[model samples]
Target: MGGTLRVNSLAIQDRRGWQKPYELTGRLVGIIGPIDRGKSSMVDCIDFVLGRSVRFKGAVDDQLVAVKAGMQIGDEEVFLHRSRRRLGVVRVEDLAGDEIATVPINASGDQQELSDWLLARLGLDDAFASVRLPHDRRLSFASDLLPYLHVRQEDIDRFVIRPQTSADDAARLAVAKLLLELINPASERLGARIHDLNNEIRNKQRKADQVRDFLNASPETNSGTLDADLDRLRDDETQAAQRLKSLRDRARAATQFAEQRQQQVDRARQRLATAEDGVDWALRRHREKATALAQIDASLAELGEVAAASSEDRERLALLYDACPACETDLSSRAVPTGRCSLCTETLPGAAQHKEKQQLQRARERLVPEVAELEQNVTRARHAADLAREQLALARRAVDEDTADAVTPYVDAITAAATELEALRSEITTLERLKEPHRRLSERQEEINRLSEELDQAREQQVRVGAELNEPDDVLQRLNNLFGRVVSEFRLPWATGRARLDRDTLLPMVDDQDFDQRGGGSRTAVSVAYSLTLMMYALEDPTRFQLPQMLILDSPQKNLGRNDHDQDLATRIYRWIIDYFEVRREALGGRYETFQLVIVDNNIPTAVRSGFDTLIQFKDPHGFIRDLDHPHGEPAGYEQLALDDELDHDGL
Candidate 1:
């Protein structure tokens, strides 16, 4: 059983920035007013605020920018607000009007959406339903239940249980099953598991098919030959490995021998470089000695020329000093001392000159022997250079001979071995590449087998859980009787007092005739009866059902005429509602205590007006938007309606 959801009030903000509040706290709340008075619009506000998808258009809807509802679920009091500008989010507030959390309108991930939040409060969070098939299950959202809870005027005469097209037919049935307690969490979980297993099996089978197709596309390989091919390839691989190893062994021995010969060649090259360097050094030393000897000879010749010049100069100076040239005085008879200068009458420089000549003579004597010794050394150095050159030539020849002997013979053998090994390895690699598709095919087949086993187990579990579904036939029988009784009261023209709910369609059938075969008014009567019957059934055992104790019907008297019979039927419908609420209240507690009903219509019959707990009425030019000057057309400054609403409710 879920907690009771009592809608306290609905507030609509219009383009004029005015919030029109309607109190819906009464058990039997009726919004009765003339046509175009926004009765349906008010119901839509409740729907929109409760997280139902509604396309807002037309005059009054265009003027509306936001809708808010204050509600009490169990012991919690909260306000839910939805803005037209922001379509996907609903703002939830606490009793103190403080913002608590913003929840998404639809289920997104693990986050609690508006539907889940409300369902949690109602103790129906675990309720689930299937859309098209029993296995295709999903959590039941508020929208799934809204079609049953709130019946629009247009749908009242057109549908028996809202056909919901092909997509949502299963959801419609699942909701009925849930309300009737024919399905529970355990059965739903098993069904969902079966659905998941089926999906996994399909996926695995698809992969297996793809792998099989790939294997078939290749003419040389298939699943049957995969093992044989692998065996042959492995044997060939082993032979190739052995051959490669033998080739490597032979190449290794040859490489060792070559390395030894290379070492000899390296030593010979080193010897050749040393001999060349020695030759160069010897030649350079010979040239240096020859140059030094030449320089010594040149110095000796210069010393001799200087000594002869000094002697000639001394003789000429002595003759010139015989007469003084400054005054033409001949001073040749003036006897100058041997160590005096004749011109200045000072000591003569002859002693210094003679000592220098003696030193020069001594140097020439020493240089003469050294020159002879240097000539001998030059000859020896040339001979040594010649010997080094000959040794260098021989060493180079030896190196060339060693290189030719070491590498040329092995080149062809090593290259042939390497080429053969590469070809063998390449063939092995190609064989391995050809084996890949077979491996994947095997893996995919294994997966398909595993998934098939799991799917079988899941199906067995589904059957076991499905067997536990309680009294589906008994529930349908009870519902059929309840539906017949409610339809009988409506006095529908097609009623034969033997009406039964169609088991498959879950719709009312009169005298074995389909619901769609009836007239408009009769259809409307059956639709209203069907909705009322569901509510009555839920009320019969509140603890066993998760349906909220609320029902909102818009214009149940939609197709009825102004005739006496038609009016009488309309009055009976209202009276039935009023009487039902009265019975429940008296049986339970006070009015507006247990179940809540809100009816939107053009007018509530005068006879049953007093039976309602709350009746809201609007006159001409007045509607849900009480202060709207223009109800059917765009008002002034309508473009700013959303902006004005945002500015006014920004704090909220």
Candidate 2:
């Protein structure tokens, strides 16, 4: 008991309900119960608590909360508690109930804490993280190794540890690698190194290609003819410089002539200004004089008409009688006075009237002379204005003609020289830009030279590593032989004509027949033989094996005990495994530590049950879930309650 490393017990607890704690224990524990009685549930709970990678497909009660398992790895006893409420979290504790660690089962690095702790307890080194052989992902998790410890009912017919239905082909290859690495840890290290080297080689090759592409696309520059090209460019530059200087000298001379023409234009503009002012003044004077002359002539004509009417009025007055027509007064002797008309009887001063007529005639005569004099002055002013205008026009025309003759040649020379210089400058800029690609080509060539050297060294290293990557064939052969011998010892229906395990498939082969061709019973027998063979091989060298020396198989009796013959064969198979363990112990002179085997089935043969160290049986409604009022292994007290109720009815 002290030497053996095995599970001591598995306990299920429901703190929220009336269900009591149900526990199963011992090395060869047989949980015998009928179908749908929580038999498979008990197996699933144990697997869950142990962190096995099997899907739970068993009965679950709403009241169930968590499951706990206790196992002894070597000399250390540990407890694992897994809560159904928190499916992936596992809490580890010592036998004394001290918390050792809490692990979350996830696909992250922190989740590996549980796996690392478990491997330490099982006396194995920590598996490298994310290390894989070719064509496989990293398969170093603690759960990844659980397949070897437990024989899952769902994958019982499968050849490898996990079923092809649940696991892919890559997982099977990983299992083979895991086995080989267990025998030779160097293979794992070598594989990881080889993977790194391959990546390095690819990365270097890509860089080299990039450099080569850059070199290939480089623009060609004729360095051998560079001197001749430069000499030609220098000659072009010299000719351009000389032409530019000559044009500049001519432009300076023409600029001086244009300045002289501008001076002439300025003088002409001044003269035009003076002439325009003079013409404006003269025209205004002429208009004022003509208006005066017109007024004078009108006054002279009016004076002449007034003189004639006055003469006629005087003659009539001399011939008329000296009486007023209206009064008929006898005033013949009263003469018509000078200031008064004779017919009106009002007298005026004759001398005064005559003087007024004389004054009128004199004023008319003086205006005519003044008008003539002003008209003569206006004519002279007009003649002088016309002469000034003619001189201004001549000056403006002379300025325009001089500007056209002198400035136009200088403007044309400057434009032609500037256009030629701009074109030459553009050519020089294009030549400068073309040289940049030549510099880039040299840089790429240097990079390619350096990378080529490194590539050669990496290739040599990769080749050496590849040579060491020989397949682990010898150890696989030994494993196959052991499995074949175990299959033969069981003597199942399919175990005939030199039975053996196929190295590639990891399944039993009877002569040339594969495990898939066998009947269900034959396969079951062969599967059990293989499971036993693995445990035996691990126990032979526990230090080198990564699998724990414990196996939990659920419901092996389904195919094993379908009929009388199968039942007999199953009985023999059980005895054979037990005897195998006993022989190993005996061979070691009681020094060998036997491993654990937990069998869960509905039918446990009476003889086989007797040899088991622990036996738990399910009957009636008394299962892992116990009734609150009526516990297991005890009859319900309903009869007593009914009797008391009857008495109360009769008033007892």
Task: Find the 10 residues in a row with the least total lDDT in model 1.
Answer: 314-323
Residue 1 lDDT, candidate 1, scale 0-100: 61
List CA RMSD, all candidates. Answer: 15.6, 21.4
TM-score of each: 0.61, 0.55
- lDDT of model 2 at residue 209? 62
TM-score of 1: 0.61
Count of clashes, each model: 12, 5
lDDT of 2 at 446: 62
Candidate 1: segments with Cα more than 4 A from true spot: 15-20, 53-59, 62-66, 82-89, 102-111, 128-142, 160-163, 184-186, 206-439, 588-592, 627-652
lDDT of 2 by residue, 1-652 (tens): 1124467777776645434445555456788876767677777776676665445443355445787777776567888888877777788899888998787765374456555556555544434343454455445434466666666666666554655543445555555455434323444455555556566656756765665455446443453343355567767777777787787786567556556556656766676676667666666766765664455455445434544665535322233434566788854333332334445645433333444344434544655666676567657666765776676577667666765666677677667767777777676666656655545655655665565555566566655654554344655576677777777666676446476666666656666777677777676666776777767666775433445667877766546656877777778777776677667776873324447788877777787677677888887655665543333224645543455777889998
lDDT on C-alpha atoms for all candidate structures: 0.72, 0.61
| Model 2, runs deviating above 4 Å | 1-5, 15-25, 52-59, 107-112, 123-125, 128-130, 133-142, 165-167, 180-186, 203-471, 504-508, 513-517, 589-594, 627-652
